[model samples]
Target chain A: MVGIVVVSHSERAAEGISEIAAEMAGDTRIEPVGGDGQGGIGTVPDAIEAAIDAAAGGDEGGDAGDLDPVVVLVDLGSAVMNADVAVELSDAEATIADAPVLEGAVNAAVAATDPSATVESVREQAEAARDVDKL
Target chain B: MTEDGAAAVAAVAAVAERIEAERDHLTELDSAIGDADHGGNMARGWAAAAEAARDLDDPDTGTVAKTVGKTLMSEVGGASGPLFGGSLVFAAAELDGGVDAETAVAFAETYLEKVEDRGDARVGDQTMVDALTPAVHTFKKSIETDDLPPIEALAKAVDAAERGVAFTVPIRARKGRASYLGWRSVGHQDPGATSTLFILEELLAVAADRLGVDAPETDATSPTIPDEDPDEGASEDD
Candidate 1:
């Protein structure tokens, strides 16, 4: 089961997006990590690290053997910076992608729940969704 | 802070802080293909938002979102200003005065639709839409399943958002500043997508922490940060 993490500057936004995704996918295993920049919400190394710890720590079962590569989605600039740092700090094999807050949240949640989905595949789907004609 | 209002205040404060922290990095990414003002613009907009939020004492989600929207529209420059600003406005309208998980999902959907309408672009355009569209759908679907707690539901959305961000790598640009670069945009990751992912990641972390769930551990390596490259990927319009 591949893990999915959503990083945002606002904890509520992260929680909101994550909650929506879980509601959509019935049995899919997914995790959400949020890093609050506290004083500010931007992409910073420390904030990113906090997000990673939150996501990695929030895995429901802690099934390390079946752990899927974590995929991170970010909202804005510093959010990206921090997310990058989080990935680095955790020493986790993960892929980061840029996406809009609302639409990407919907598409990513659906893709993450698919059993055969991999980080690469999910990335492709997200990119594909960018083309209005395709949608 | 009222029972429901506290979350909104907290959310706005968190977003403002995150933006301030990441302003430089955003500018760096924009400098690659834009006017090199993405960070500055975002910082100014978010600073204004933070100030307004702080002044509110205690406000509802809609009020906070409106403040964010107005600040971004008035203070920020470039394409992202209107795009992000409009998104917040739409979300505020949808959220009305609520800040629950369901309202959040609805606000996101409204935000996506507005972006799509404003940009006239869809998925695979290598825009932020790529990330947002998927995440919203996933959230809606998850809610339809069972009555999972809010935290569990957020976990599912985070998963979807991660997948959405990952899907941006091979896409060719058809809109925004990257469109002029055409195929050149294929190999490079979209900055919009990157930022969107950052927002989602932050949201996930906050949600999980609120839920008191143990974080998932990973064993992956960090990504390499390349030196600032020239604007070979800049859109023709830019």
Candidate 2:
């Protein structure tokens, strides 16, 4: 199973979205990081990096070893920029999904929760949401 | 600390002070064309950068530069964080040990290139590039043609940057949040360009201090006190 990291400019938005996605997350790790540290509306690269660490289970002295690849989903503008920079700095195997944050996270949660889901499969399902009809 | 390294820190500290003082003004400018956070973001970023520079443990100039970049990237939010922060990181990669006239010229040139590549902005985009491009070109030209002392060359660069900032007032933005305004973005100075000019002015001040010459005070901006010579066992601020 792949892990999911949700990045939004608003801290509450990221956490709320993570919570929604978690309903379908099963055993997969889903972490949320957002907002400038000062309670402002902006994303922080350091926060994103920390979320990636938690998703990959790297904070407990070492990798939990059972962790899967992590995927990041970002909202507009600097969220994407900061996330890209964070991923580069972390030197991790994480990839940012190009899908919409809410829709992608929901689809990704379901895909990643499956025991057979690989990082690629999770990303595919997440991205495929773009074509899903929503009446 | 080497002479050049100490001078570099002084330059960044000067920028931090200037940004802090002008923060509200910068925000006012941004409010007209973009999000009003540019001022706050730059102020916080420079504060972190100044702290990093002050606390450097006699490291090489390159390490100091890298630390500044990393700190800004981590501390600053919004588009300027990555663009300005990435520029410093790239410049640090280009810099070696002690700073010299040629190395400073190289830093400006490389910084300009990195910003262009990262932002995909041009000279007329009403972005930071509008100011930085001219300043860098002026710096490089002064170094190549007249082989002027570092202070004089940097003065020209600062002058060019100021002119660039002024030129942004009437141009419609083509990039960043300001671009969303289309023609409405005209008639206001770009916050990024103004800040870029401030940074160049501080750099020129550093050059003048290093050469022990009084920089020409063409504008009302106050001059910064030069750091004590490295032999003086660091300044009180250190």
Quote each prediction's TM-score: 0.55, 0.83
Chain B TM-score for each model? 0.81, 0.88
Instruction: Please give, for residues A35-87, the per-residue lDDT of candidate 2 as tens digits.
Output: 98889898887789889877876764654465457889988887888887777
Per-model C-alpha lDDT, please?
0.62, 0.83
Q: Find the candidate with the highest DockQ and give its number.
A: 2
lDDT of 2: 0.83
The segments of candidate 2 whose C-alpha lies over 4 angstroms from its true place after superposition are A60-68, A113-121, A131-133, B117-120, B141-152, B214-238
TM-score, first chain, each model: 0.72, 0.92
Candidate number achieving the greatest lDDT relative to the actual structure: 2
B6-90: candidate 2 lDDT, tens digit per residue: 8778888999999999999999999999879899989999999999999998867788788888888878779898888867887
TM-score of 1: 0.55
Query: Can you write out model 1's per-residue Cα lDDT over B1-238, one digit (the tens) per residue?
Result: 6544555556556766777788788777666555567777777777787777778867776887777776665455445655677567656887775777677768877988877766667998887788888777766665555555555555555555566666776777788777777777676566666666666666666656655675332112101111223254354438
Residue B86 CA error for candidate 2 (Å)?
Answer: 3.9
